[model samples]
Target: MDTPQNTALMRALTELPGPLPARGVIHIAIRHTDRFTVVSNDLAQHPTLSTVAVGLAVRIQSLPQGTEIGIKALAARFPEGEKLIAAALRELEAHGYLQRARTRLPNGRIVTRTVFCNQPAALLRTRVAAARPQQPPAPPQAPALPDVQQEQAPEAPAPQDHAPFVALVPPPTAPRQPSPPLPQPRELTAELDRAATALLSDLRRHASQLVLSESDVRQLAPAVAAWLERDTHPDTIRHTLTNDLPQPLRHPAKLLKHRLTVLLPPPLPGADDLAAPARPRIAVTPFQTCDGCERAFRAPTPGHCRDCRNAHGPAQAAAA
Candidate 1:
């Protein structure tokens, strides 16, 4: 009878943890190895590699050679399933644990395969290993056959001409075109300068210590505008300047100016900050861009802007 598949082996293989220790548990057994690969702090704590990635790495390391390893098959065996496993595998490949390459065989067939490494191997070593040809094992001699009608073994296909191996990992994607530079905000003017003067003048009445002359306000207006740019409300600035004070009347203008300049908060994020995605976001759109306007617009083919189409009519109609 054919041997039954080992369910226990499958379970043990799927449930391995990463290099990190689990929290808040006294371990009955630890997945310890004397010959385990030592990873760098940067690789171990990489932001892209999550717990799912760690588990996948561990699983890949523990599995025996020639085991049926694929995203679909591994997904069924793990709790996190295929999507997580696939993502984790990609993470592992990115971090030097695995490399996917499309290689041409001696038979002129191209196959995509992943090279797994328990430790980070040098690029030269990896290339050399991948380039090295794997030879078929020698066949055992058969018992002497009868002279009558003994058939000769079929000849193996001739090996193709040698070619250099090429790594087929997807190229690094194009960097995000930086957001268009922001237009400078309008420059401060005399009217706005007067408004700032009024703001500081009003503050002196609240606290006798806040002594600011008209000249001081003109100098201080730009600083106040900077505070506003940092997201400090006008009322809050007033309260901060007037509420806390030394009892004696002194050079309060200098003190207030010092607070404004020294304690300035960080600038608020711009429109781009809100628009940007938290992680690398890639999207493929079906809509084509308008030929005339060069902006994305709905179209079947020979895409033209609405204005161009309306004015010139469809290219087909124009041609006809």
Candidate 2:
């Protein structure tokens, strides 16, 4: 116990401060072997997200799949209210940490499918790479021999003029073709143009993935006006654009442009004849005089009334 090593350790312990500085936080780190979630610095020290949102994301990432993380479920579990939980979820979605898609089952039931990304940036890169066309890799070249080997084999014949080395060049990549132009709207009015612009700008409020740049809004405004011209309600337009959105939506403007072009409603009928036919009216049976009792009753042909039929049946039975 009184060895030189023990004495040195005791001296070192005494030299160290009894307590850490009275300022900043000190972490007593532990090596956890189990039941610990690994959170990335991007999320743990998020510059833009609120504390609630970051914490919520961590909690969600730790949970198993199919666990309920809905606003109601989270509100029940945590001290936060439903409103706060809902806002935090929206924040996560906006920042690419969460995505919710409404999918219809084979049984015609609609359910919300949620996907959480711990590394949103990595996921985005993966998606982009997958979407890009794959190019053939260049062939590997043989390694050069060491200088010592060359010196030892100085008598070896050099490459002949006929066998001149040719460099291996990669094939040229095809240029990306420009996307086809979006269909133009019918003659736009001042009011229609303003409404369309407003709708495009306001899309972010409903779905944050749809936040468009000013230039994008200007470009896509006419297509939206076309929808309005077809008498499509604003709510309908919003739902169609925002619902069932793909996770990690890389190009919102492009997606919106495609939907506006392809999903455009047919123009309202111009003439009465062009409109859908009116529903057929039901025909009522005509009232006819019963042959047996001279009673008025509904029938396709002259027939005995129920009372007359019953009376005749009893009389016939009595006679029999």
Candidate 3:
């Protein structure tokens, strides 16, 4: 039975890219299970992390603190190169093993930094945290009033005065004229109306079995307009609705509406689909070599490999 840890280890080891044939020599970095932080097996089962991503997680866990790492550098070390590395870095960042941000200094210099982590930390950001909204102060309480009665105190005697007055009524004003009606907003442009009619005509022409009423065309017109608003070509819309339609259709309009609303791809962002600027490539390892055995390790160790450490007698003392 293969455990999750063993499976992940085997996967990382196998997926790492082979060195170029004429590169003279290939350098491999090794990590001891007892030396560095232990990663959870749950990361291997992560939905977004690919094989390359798993490899990267293993490599990154062995790196020293504050070691400068980048996608380009990791790509060089991993198989299938740049694009794969870029995607894997993105996956790692999403999973909280890595964070990247572009920072501007007081001197107006801007720099991009990638942070690698053995544990989850707060996400990095180029923008500062939003200031919390200020709360209003509580209203002051009113003083309590004692009960008093003015009605029981006193009453003045009433005096009578007699006078004759006549009532007057104002003349009626002339009848008001009715205001002119405001023009209603046009729901569809003339070109759009024409295109919608053309679309309906094509639908009726191709799927003659579908019974389309006037109301059905009216309802489907706006949906077609929405697809056009999303930058779908009118001809493409026409063909999509017309082709691959089921024979002896019961409700054509409903079917087309479902496809138009549900199947439409979201509008692409300008140039690239990503919301942030593309991350630049950086080196993943610090490139340190052991002093005793002359073996290159992912990060700086105690000047020796595990074998050298044991031979040098420090391992036993450290254990003690």
Candidate 4:
């Protein structure tokens, strides 16, 4: 039973803070009395991992092509530093959330690439259909260069043609940097946001487990689509979400998910049964303790017998 306000989700994260990164754009930063958690949206099947993965993935949707991102560049966005990503990547590999493919860069350095594909099975085809390579905006037609008519006149008849002093010189130009292409279209940003939110909702419903590599949690939607549509191979989902995607789409979800992955514990031996699941620690007041300072507090709640909870807030207990 998943819902918009899933208590189980909150409890799960509060207990296992390791997988989530404490900070970063593509991570989830969850602070508790004990420590921090970082989760990775780039990893697959990340269950109990934070939902922040979706927005972060979408955020990296429009990175410029030919740019290779590393851990340092990633740290600028989310709290999940490079170390956590390395760990998450391995964890995801273990869970089959991502497939690790090594590529030889132009400099001959081998680098691993991860793909993210977290769409629902039913919608994967639709998503892939939508994810076809889109052309970048047409450079605004170079503003037409204000085509000025030079009106070249015969050399001998120049006296009658504006005193023949017309020279074919270009007009004084405005500053070259045209204000950075108007910061992209607001409509496009909103569109991506809508798409990301929808995909996120779909993911929350379909993902049964989370995939982690080292520690980054990859979403499973794009993978679903890839599995269904060979034409839209999901080879780049991982890197796109982590380093190549644009802004807006990679909002809080991914950043939060990354934060969650940081809190994951080391792998247990054998067939995964030894891996005990974490449980939430809720502070409860005992039924028979002093009402004043409910130490393990034995006062019946709502009785106002003695704890500061009666006087102050429900979270803190003190003598009344």
Candidate 5:
């Protein structure tokens, strides 16, 4: 069956949401030895190593801040007792895999967050990126031509009907290229799994404290899942799911299924209603209005509307 380290890693992977922040007492809880570290490295080229690394990163943060313990408890937390935990952790240590530590005073008088141990600097940036918020690549659009105008000149009025015959306009054409098919549910599942793992590693590195709230958990899920769902890598799905799920949903399957049906598809909404909701046709009072046209508005970007406020300069004095 699965090893204790594997079991611990799995628990961390499935139940935890986001990364393990440097703060908070992270407990390895190995039944074998507290001295051992569980880690995975690319050079060693162990697939399971990578999976474990991803899982650890994700779970570390979700652990409640200030929770403290040791190797034995962690090993016992999962099934199969401590066998897998011992085996896996030893294997990781042999290959230069490592973990962080917050040591107590030499006498064990007080818990002190001693500097991290065995954290490889070279791998850090990548871990951070995986866990951090990722803005989805904007859908490919017409390449920006510096002076291209959104508003084309109104066609000269055609002399015909008295009122004026409005010419039917054809939609503008873009280069036609078929998009790839949406992945099947299974495909989506695997992709998300890998992304989840990667994000876990990053979360562990970046988070300052453990214990994220439910809203906070929900906030990070979409970004993490989006990283998985839309990724093109072959192993991406499995790794992401392996890392992200299992831990956060440590709740009974029924509860987990009811709470979170899926781990991937963050870009897509689980609930029927989602996203910024339809922009109201009529702007609300809190929103600003264009001084020139009096059209109440919210600009797509943070700064301002083109007609109302110029990026380079001030809004032209006009009727409010």
Candidate 6:
């Protein structure tokens, strides 16, 4: 077993003939000592998310709170463009990895609050906890007295009918009024929808202040389509949305939405009649016998047909 030839053969088998050929994928992982993010495998290897979405989610999780993750900002930072970035954000939101809520501050300014969840399960747990009913805390217990002292304590007296009673009423809270329902758009065809979307997207060309995000375009597209459905011109829509610009307009989309809803024109008159199938018209011509040749001919009234009238002289026709 310890023969020289056997030892030589084992050394040859263990030694490489050259550098090993690269195969599949190999990872030379480096442990991060700083500026590293911890992402859940559930998110990193999500079955339904695209690669772009996963990367975006990871980027969002690594950022500090209050960091701007808007579509425009992300598009500027990355090469994916606004549409793709917006789609990725939507994917994250749909999968419960992100949440954006619009809140009105005490200063009467509306702002969006974004919440990012590293683990979707954590988000679900938060929602469940918030929805659960909370039990009241137990009242403080009275200290126990000595056995002999407790037996000698005086008994409490009950209230009499002559004594005045006061009810413990809770302080009144401000009532919350429900927000009015948003305007709904009429049914739209593909062409109409495209036209509406294009119009909304092109608003910035007319007024730079009217620049809208991709999501704003989508949300307002239907309202624009409703205007188009009523035969409103694109120029009219653009003018209505862009005219009388407010100085330092904070929310263009909201202003546009209000204008589109409030200024919507009624459908053209006889539009239903035009859409309905027209009744087939039938000519009810009366048959007449010509006195000249005793030939039957069709006429609106008791008169000769075109040929008979032409053949007859002008004077004779007038006399007849």
All models: lDDT?
Answer: 0.66, 0.83, 0.64, 0.41, 0.44, 0.77
Top candidate, metric lDDT: 2
How far off is model 2, as Cα RMSD?
Answer: 15.4
**Model 2, backbone clash pairs (residues 3+ apart or across chains), number:** 0
- Model 2 lDDT per residue over 54-122, tens place: 999999988988998888888888899999999999999999888887655654345787888787776
Candidate 6 residue-wise lDDT, 1-320, digit = tens? 57998787666655746564577643335589999999889998899999999999988888888898988888888888999999999999999788876654554345777878676675455556555799899999998766874557686998675422221222234376564443555677898879988998888999999989999998988888888887778998888788766667898888887677666677877857669787999979878887667788886667666776787768696899
RMSD of 5: 38.0
Q: lDDT: which is higher, 5 or 6?
A: 6
Least well predicted 10-residue stretch by lDDT in candidate 5? 163-172
Candidate 4 lDDT: 0.41
The local lDDT score (0 to 100) that residue 224 gets in candidate 6 is 85
Query: What's the count of clashing pairs in each model shown?
Result: 0, 0, 2, 119, 43, 0
Please give, for residues 1-320, the per-residue lDDT of candidate 1 as tens digits: 23345665555545766553656633335466775644445455657678778767777666767665678767777677788788888888887877765544544344557777654634445566766798899999987765667677777999996544344442244366553322121466665556556778888678776777778876778777666656678788887677546446468777677567555666788899879577866865468778778877766665777887786776668699
Per-residue alpha-carbon lDDT of candidate 5 for residues 68-160, written as tens digits (9 for 90 to 100): 323465455544246555554454444444433333243323343311223343344445554588998988889656556566667698878
- How far off is residue 227 in model 3, in Å? 0.5
How close to the true structure is residue 204 of candidate 4, measured as C-alpha lDDT? Answer: 28
> Candidate 6 — what's its lDDT?
0.77
CA displacement after TM-score superposition, residue 310 of candidate 2 (Å): 61
Candidate 1 accuracy as lDDT: 0.66
CA deviation > 4 Å runs, candidate 6: 1-23, 126-320
lDDT of 3 by residue, 80-113 (tens): 5777777888888888787786654444344667
> Alpha carbon lDDT of residue 254, candidate 5?
33
Clash pairs, model 2 backbone: none
Per-candidate TM equals 0.28, 0.40, 0.28, 0.20, 0.19, 0.36
